[model samples]
Target: MKCEDFLFLNNQVCVIVGAANPRSIGYATAELFAHYGAQIAILDVAVTDTTQAALRTAMSAKVGREVDLLCIPCNIVDPVACDRAMQMVVEHFGQIDSLINCAGIVRSEGMLDIPSQDLALMLDVNLKGTFHTCQSALAFFTKQQKGTIVNLASVAAQRGGGLVGGAHYAASKGGVVSLTKSIAREFGPQGIRANVICPSMTETGMLDGNVTEEQFNQVVAGIPLRRAGKPLDIANACLFLASDLAAYITGHTLDVNGGGHIH
Candidate 1:
């Protein structure tokens, strides 16, 4: 089939979390979804009028039209906030067809150096936050009998903490993977699909100050692809999983690594 024949998300309303930063995976996913004609609702803890305006302008330029975008301030660590955010999207868009969770934080501190507070914060935002958002979306999906979820985990969760994250981050992401699988199993009978994406050493602001140029090059040298993963690489995977293209797939963990951690 031709590429244009694969317009899978036309008119679908998709919710993307943690998309305030233009360089983030969340933003890339939102942009790609809009390119495929999906209406977008971006929820971020750092969202502001300025950021929202910039995002709207940038997206409009790229899409060659006035993009349908909604920006809302949300802290996914709070369940109430997540629920309210979902409600707001439904109110604005009439319904939500998919949710892509790219909201998370990573720390490079080792297990021995990780403080209790740091661990708690990591788990709260990465694992518990994912739980909250998924639960909130499931409320509507259960009633509608269909929905799709694409969650962002990390290679840290698989290889036990890699170049940019610590033990706490890995543990939190592991919980995310497990939680998504459980959701897929429990909600599959209801026609709700849930999946996880584990990206390795992506080119994002997350690497700034976390890994030096030397460290990054050293890791990339070992990968067969001879390069790091890109936000668009993961975004493409997300689009496929979120769209009807993968309707029969659920509870699967897709690795968007540049052949970095093949297993």
Candidate 2:
């Protein structure tokens, strides 16, 4: 196979969940995939006509071509919503090739002091929401006998919450890790691939709004790479795992933490 062939998306339909803002990792992935010839269907609870238009404009600029973009207002926490949103994507695009689960929530409350409501919200959005989308997509994937799933986890899930998220957030992401592996194992025989990307302190809205400059500097100092990750950094990893380059890889957790795993 040619080097370029590994990265080519070739008009595949990629559904990105949790692309609420243009600065998010989901949007970055959508842009990169679009550049490689994928039609983008973005799902977010906050999606609006304005945000959709902006995303389409930005993606077209990046790819230097008009993009087929679908923006759906979807709350992944609802199974019916997930199913309906995916159905809409299929109806619009004809087929679903990949599903990227980036929909999640985070908070800075430790296990001992975490509020009950906060814990529930995290589980609902991070863990249960992932479950809903994966389950909904499974119907199409299994029927077609080919699909890819890339779920976003966090380093907090690996380290037990030392960064921005607290125990609840960590637990929810940890559940994502396990859930992704389960899908990989169960569906590998059916030509479905599932993997997780654990990003460490990415420079996204999720962290910017929650951390001060001092705290951010301290965290970066500890990282061997001496900088926080960018949404593009995580997006690149998604591109690889979603592409044929990773066709043989499944049930794997790719860490995009810039050597924070070493520290």
Best by TM-score: 1
- TM-score per prediction, in order, is 0.98, 0.97
Those runs of model 2 whose alpha carbons end farther than 4 Å from true positions after fitting are 1-7
Clash pairs for candidate 2: none
Deviation (Å) of 118 in candidate 1: 0.1
lDDT tens readout by residue for model 2, 151-183: 999999899786799988889999999999999
> Model 1: residues >4 Å from true position, as ranges?
1-5
Q: How far does residue 74 in candidate 2 sit from its true spot (Å)?
A: 0.1
CA-lDDT, candidates in order:
0.95, 0.91
What is candidate 2's TM-score against the reference? 0.97
On a 0 to 100 scale, what is the lDDT of residue 146 in model 1? Answer: 94
